[model samples]
Target: MNGLPMVVSEPGLPAKVTIHEVGPRDGLQNESGIVAAADKAEFVRRLADAGLTTIEVTSFVPPAWVPQLADAEEVFAAVRDDPAVSPALNLPVLVPNMRGLDRALGLGAQQVAVFASATETFAQRNLNRSLDAALEMFEPVVRHASEDGAWTRGYLSMCFGDPWEGPVDPAKVVDVGVRLLETGCWQLSLGDTIGVATPGQVGALIGAFERAGVGVDKLAVHFHDTYGQALANTLAALRLGVTTVDASAGGLGGCPYAKSATGNLATEDLVWMLTGLGIDTGVDLGRLVATSTWMADRLGRPSPSRTVRALAGASAGEKQ
Candidate 1:
C-alpha cells in the first residue's frame, strides 16, 4: 500500500505514462478454452476499478478466426451497460477489416485498431495478404473508420524480427508505419512480435520514424518479454519521448496467429518500473496485483509477471 520507489525522475522521460491495457482482448484471444462472456465482463470491470483507463475489451474479427472472443458483442454490451465500468474508459477493440469495423461500430464501439505486419511472411501468414496489400487494405478501412470519427490505431507487428523472416529492416518498418499514419490512423504501435529487440534497435527504429517525420506523440511501443528485453526497450522508448506503452495483466497474451510471439509486457511489471522511475501511470499497484491474481486463479494458473508474483507473495507473507 506504499509507493516504495523514491521519486527519482529521469530528465528525458515524461512525467506521466499511459499504459494501454490489452489483457482482456489480447490475453484471452490466445486461450484455447472458452472464457465466458460474464467472466470477461467482470474482468473488464475489475480492470477499470483498478484504475486502468484504457482497456482493449475484445476483437471484432470472425468467430472462426478467434473463437475465444466469439462473444465480443455480448462482452462489449455487458461492459457498456455496466454502471461500474466508466463511460470515459477507452475500450478499444481490434478490427481486421471493413466488415469487422462495421460490426464493431454497429455495437457502439468508439476506439478501434487495425493490425499490420512489418514483414512480408508475417503479413501473408497473419493476414493472408502481402505487406503492402495489407496496408492497402487498411487504407480504406482506416479512412472509413476515421470518417465515422472513431479513434483508430494501427498496430504494426514484427517491427523488430519475425520467426519466418528474421531481422526486419527498420526502413521497411518505417515505410509501412508511414503509410498507415498517412491513412489517418491516430497512432501507430510498433510491435516486437518475437521479443528479440534490444535497446539500441528500439532507439534506432524510433529515430528512423523521427527521420520520416513521425514523432513520438503518434507512436507507442508494444514489446514482449520473451527475451527479457521488454522493460529495457520500454525504457529506451520512454527516453525517446514515447508516452504510451502496451501491456497485459499477469504477463499474459501472445499472438494467437504468431506462435513465436510470447507474453506481452506485464502491466504490473511495467507499473513497478515506472513507479521506481517516479513516473505516474495512474494504476494502484496493490489493487492491480490483486486483480491479476484474481484473473490468474480464474485462468487456473499463476501470473507470469515478476512484479505481480513478488508483490502478491510479499502481501501473502504479511497476512501470515
Candidate 2:
C-alpha cells in the first residue's frame, strides 16, 4: 500500500488519532521466540521517545500461557522509572483475570486490559471458557480495577468473523461490548481478530454500539491485516469519530484462530495513513519505522509493513 492519498480532497476528517502501541504485549506474545526483558525495555523506551502516547509495555498473563511475557514485572519496572517517558501516558498490560490484574497492580500499572470474544467457539478456544463464563470471570476483575482507580480497557475479539464459525452476529458483539462498558471499563476495543471486517461491517458494529446507547468516546478499534482491510476499516471508524486504535509495530501478531490471518495493522502503516489524512498521531514515522526494523532484525525476518519497505527503499535510493 502507498498509504493515504496526499490530495486535499476530503473535506471532513478527524484532526488527531491515538495510536496505542501494543508491540510489547500483543506483538511479542505471538512471536514464536522469546524476547529478552532488557531488549523489551529498550524497545519501550525507544517507542516512548518516538512520542507514542500509549505503549502496551507487557502482559500479566501467566508464564505458562504466554511464555513471551513472563518478564512482565521486569518490563513494567523498567519503564516505570524512565522519567522522560510520557508522564500522564498509560502503559496498559493485558490482564486475563484477577490474578493477572493483581500482578499488574503489584507492578504499579495504572491501566490494565481484559479480552473476550463475540463467538462462543472462539471464547472457549482462546480463553478455555464459554462466553458467559468468560464474562463472569472478567466482571470481578473489572470491578476491582475500577474500585482501585485504575483504567481498564476490554477487548472483544472476532467481532466481524471467526475462523471456526463464519460471520459473527453484530448484536452479540454489541451485547458483550455493552457488558464490558457496564463493568466500568474505561474503553471497549472491538477487534477484527481475523481481519475479515469490511468498511460496512465496521459501520454496522459502530451503529449497533450507538443504538445500544454506548458512547463512541469509549469505543476503540483493533483490526488485523489478514485480508488487507484494516486500513479501510480504520477509515470507517475514523469517520464515525473513533480515535483510539490498537496496532503493533512491524505488524507482528496474527490471530491464533485464523490460519491465514496476518497480523495487527502495522503502527508505521497506521501512522503513515493517518498523517497523510491530516490526522495527527504524535508518532514520528521515521522513528517508528526504525523501531520496527530493530524488532524485525531480532526476529530474523523482514517487516510486513508496506510503509516500512517503501521508506527503506526510498532511503536506499537517496543514499545511492
| Candidate 2 similarity to native, TM-score | 0.95
Model 2: per-residue Cα lDDT at residue 6: 77
Worst 10 residues of 2 by lDDT: 1-10
Candidates' C-alpha lDDT: 0.92, 0.86
Which runs of model 2 end up more than 4 angstroms from their true locations? Answer: 1-9
TM-score of 1: 0.98
**Per-residue alpha-carbon lDDT of model 2 for 1-320, expressed as tens digits?**
34234735245677878888888888888788889898898889888877898999988888888888899888899889877676677788899999999988987888999998889998898899999999999999998988888889999998999888999889989998888788788899999988899999999999999999986798999999888999999999989989899999888887545565778999988987888777878888888888888888888998999888888767667779
Give the TM-scores of the predictions, in the order they appear.
0.98, 0.95
Q: What are the clash counts of all predictions, listed in order?
A: 0, 0
Clashing pairs in 1: none
